[model samples]
Target: MPTWDNVPKGQMTAAVLTNPGYSADPSDCFTYSTDYPRPTLPSPEWVLCRVHAAGLNRAELRGRTGAAPFIGEFIIFQKEYREEPPKILGEEFVGEVVEAGSASGFTEGEKVTGFLNGGGKAYDGAYAEFSLSHRRRLYRLPATTKLPWNVLAAVPMSMYTAWGALNLAAGLGERRKKDNKPVVVLIHGATSSVGVWGLLVAKDAGATVIATTRNTEKIEKLKAAGADHVVLEDDIDTEVLKIAPDGVDIVVELVGPDHIARCANLCARRGTAVLVGPLNKNWSAGKFEPFYIPPTRNVSFFTMTNSGPGSEDADVDHPTVEALLSDVVHKIETGVYPQEVVVDKTFALRDIGKAHQYCEENRAVGKVVVTVP
Candidate 1:
């Protein structure tokens, strides 16, 4: 068998999702499948990449737990386009292009990073030795990018997500007259991967940012991540009000449904509240009566759905995935964003169980990336 990097031409190693149960065990979730076939170039716009390192996302647990924000619909999509059994599990990856179809606009051997498509099977991700992505979605790294591939691996999904949520929901690039004014902003779940990048984007847009985190240890980290003010979760309301008595102009809510109401209520008149994840173990929000808010002081809610049409554009009220990726890459190239990648830890692909366990526990200060040797 022809091999490159120890992976056979037609076959590769992958962490197959053998059990799709929402159980409390990590080891019981993934199993090594050596005979997993490498994906063929699907179209002229597709590129086959050799995986270098794949970053773990909170969304990665959706399949195992069946508790995603869109798990039901994702399952339906998978059942419709079902292919391989067991399924490949992963999302964002940094890799070297092994085969770029003639129309892909990518060159062989170029280092690139981006996220997997949204439709089809949810598990056709970057957890394998080889994976596929579209040229329109992939971002080629800048020649001046000095970050290691392991660190750069963590940027694509999180950055795109953060940028989308902030720009789309919070109006980062909106053409309002108030756009030039420094608005008071609150970032919930301020230390999570998306939260950190959101903080940076908000700061760059000249908003005065107030960040919230339950972990006191992350306060300094959040500040370092460009948060102007950091508050513990319990102090969110009081502290945020103290900083912006009338309420914040925008709230980047990553903490999910449990605290969304409170965060929304904290928005100033016509202010925006955006949700990026459901990190608090609750995905669904229960119905409740409307809280008394001023007629002028109403808040609008938006969810960060990073897929489907116009998912890549920043219209007045939405963000395009492609635009955000390009912005983040350019910022990294110019050293405007932080050069250091906040990797809490790295795990060999073989030790994936331990990696999943760590992410499950939510003990990491930054991202947990799995490296492919």
Candidate 2:
């Protein structure tokens, strides 16, 4: 157990999702309250963090609209919340540890950022002034770091997903090492946060990147983010072939399953296509045939939340995640990674609905963040 001697109060402000269904108005999804009970340490390995900022993701929108079947079938049951409890919804946060259990491997007042099993029964999410997380899911920020809380919060989930999908799931790093030539990568939905990060990461790894967007206006923006070639969504196949005649070595698919067949067709022989996002909100591939992709090409899926503690599918453990995060921080500090391209906007926690609306409307060029001041 941990002592709460430093805690200012037992209650804290939180944005709770009392309703979990689709609504035209985003504000209808949450019931914000200042008297929401602050969570305590679940065990000695857990720590209580004073949240400074939280990142907004499409997953939360799916959670709100009962579109995330993986979360649970219970999400669609309104009657259950009346009997049980309505959980908070958020996945990534940057905060200071206020109460550290003896076995948590952390001391009080340390700044950390990482993913949480948000909205799950075991632990509440980061939509509160305070949240609880196991030590394994967190990365301690250096005392000398100068990054803002919102920027730090935005990096974890997007960066982790992009890095994991490309390197681990799609084997971009290994492919780069093996191939004497520069590996070619295609990032579909290149304007999304994950797509933006994927473009940066692939460019940083010395890969020739071809990025795609629905709007032609964002083509310049993608190029500015280090894309060697930018193609409109409709012209992706034609334009990509013009750039890489042999097809791309890796495809980071952020547009969802609707484009899986097309993306797979664009892959080079023995290349990999990793689906990392569901931006279209369409879960079904709609008559997608497995035989459409030849045995020579591969299709894979990646979920950033799978790496949280206790997940059997997690390939990279805590220490590896921490090291990657540390490298990202160094890149941000040294201006290698442009901070402006990482976070597009910030909203106060009270205005979370507006933030959600902005993100869902696709107005943000990068990540949308909610600050918990």
Candidate 3:
């Protein structure tokens, strides 16, 4: 088996995801190790990504209370594709290409990361410090941005999600191009990583963005992040009404269908509500009074998962993902991504359970990344 210690500088590390199984927690789900073969390496459809960091997404939990990293739909392999089991589990990651395929330079010692499809299953992942990626699934990290392990690792999944939902899934501004201004926006779960990027996008598009959160302490942070108004997620009427008496043009929802009715009510004549969060929870919004929409409202609701269709584009087309990768590297090099106090607590990879518990408790904020040395 190959080890990273033997790999030269500008060489690649062999990685692994171990003994996958169905579980309710990641403690039972993931195993990270450097002991592994280089496989056949990629003749094509493969690039060796020298991972700097990997991010964790709530989606990784698969409703399992952080007990397990998610594995996508299983297929019984036939002649069309070769299948392997108990592989590495990860979707979004930031890394560098230490080697390239036959085609071009989305490879070869270039800092990079993106959304993964076969990552934890038929492919390798970032937990082990190096991984493999199909060329289409990765982007080169900007030379100007320097990323710390945690932010660099986490940014790909969350930010790309924001790009998919805000820009593509709901077409947040497709019809409003004629207007001198950007589309007016409402972003729920403002403090969440994806929510923050969504707000940034709306603000960048020149919209009057309204963000929501249940935590009052984050109001200042949300405001500083460019939210025009920060409202409590639980309280819809008073705060949202005050912000927009008529309605808002776009709503990027992360809390799920529980707020669908409120979102529907506040949607303007032709607004859109993009649902990118979990919807299986107890989200009974009751019923609406009027089933038809004529002179009143013409809102559209959509559901998007990172799988299916052009979802793979999160690795390719997201401008913010590029920015995030660049910014992390820049911060690492020039020191500029805002070092907001490392808090009173830090942990090692062995204490992953404690880290998950701490984060789930929501006792702290400002990034919690496990340092694996």
Candidate 4:
């Protein structure tokens, strides 16, 4: 065993969900425990990391509130709530490798950032002093990058989801490569972290990006973040029609299922509308009719977790995810993508409940992060 510093004999401090159910106040569900068992490597592909910072996602809030159907099932079906230790919730983190298995291809003290399907049986998450991650789930940060741990922590999940939604699911990259025509993209909920990243990515790809935000205060910020035009969410269709005339070539729908019809209608003929996030906390689209989606346009769904190892399509999708992550890191390093634009708030790990509350209230314009000190 490698000698580890600041690690207790077999335990570590972590913010855990003592109860997995809805609470109007997020603080009621989380507890800080000093004796939470340090997760061990399950196999040679996994490594233990000392988490420096973690990024909060809306999914965690949904999962905590029992709104996430799959995550809730994973926790309840595993009987995690009835167990001695409850579940930890987090998906993206920046940290250092403290212990590595041979196949993990990482050395002790190597700085890294990663995303995992946390709050599951395989391993706990990054809302702790320590986290466990598989080698494939991580990206080794370049030594010369000037980004901080909190900013780096904000990148993995949001960036991966944005890139996947656009390139893999919606074929933004392929379309850009094949057609010399200008591509117009509409990113709904563009003030959210993933929406902002999607705007940046589409802009970087030379698209004419029109972004949407309900808050008028975020218009200038969205423009600064590379939105060609920013419109109020209430009148997006009217305003966007004024800009594009024939509808946009792609629509990144981060709002929720309830708005899929509007998103599909906004897509140009033969264009795609990719559903990336549910910022509105609405999961179901009841009483759907196929006519709601125009035949000339397409709608697709994307989730980063589904591409991880062991998923049905992982063999085909995982490698693409790895390449995309490395490419994103490279872009950040080269100044092609801005890192500072994505992080809106930082809270200490001890203030996790407050962090959750901040995100749940939709108060953050970008990513909300918690640093572990």
* Most accurate candidate by TM-score: 2
lDDT-better candidate, 1 vs 4: 4
Instruction: Report model 4's TM-score to 2 decimal places.
Output: 0.85
For candidate 2, lDDT tens digit of each residue in 73-158?
12222122222223677877999999998998999989888576533333467888988877767678766778889889879888
User: What order do you get sorting by lDDT, best first?
Assistant: 2, 4, 1, 3
Of the pair 2 and 3, which is ahead by lDDT? 2
lDDT of 3 by residue, 1-373 (tens): 1122322334233323343434445465444344544433444556776555555445433322323322332111111122343344454566667677776446466777756552344444444456666565567666555445565554565655676677676676575743464567888776666677677667656788898777888888777766788888677777787777767877887777566666777877777777665423333344644353334544443322334454544434546456655654554355333334212145454544455455555543334444444
Question: What's model 4's overall lDDT?
Answer: 0.76
lDDT per residue as tens, model 1, 83-179: 2322666766888899998998889988788565432243367888888876765667654566677777767767766776776566766725354
Q: What lDDT does the true structure give each of the candidates?
A: 0.69, 0.79, 0.55, 0.76
Model 3 CA deviation exceeding 4 Å by range: 1-43, 63-87, 103-105, 118-124, 147-149, 170-183, 279-351, 363-373
Residue 220 C-alpha lDDT in model 2:
80
Per-candidate TM-score against the hidden true structure: 0.81, 0.88, 0.70, 0.85
Model 4, runs deviating above 4 Å: 1-9, 19-24, 66-68, 71-86, 118-122, 176-181, 305-323
Q: Show the lowest summed lDDT stretch of 10 residues, model 2.
A: 73-82
* Candidate 4 lDDT by residue in tens digits, 260-297: 88888888888899876678777666666768889899
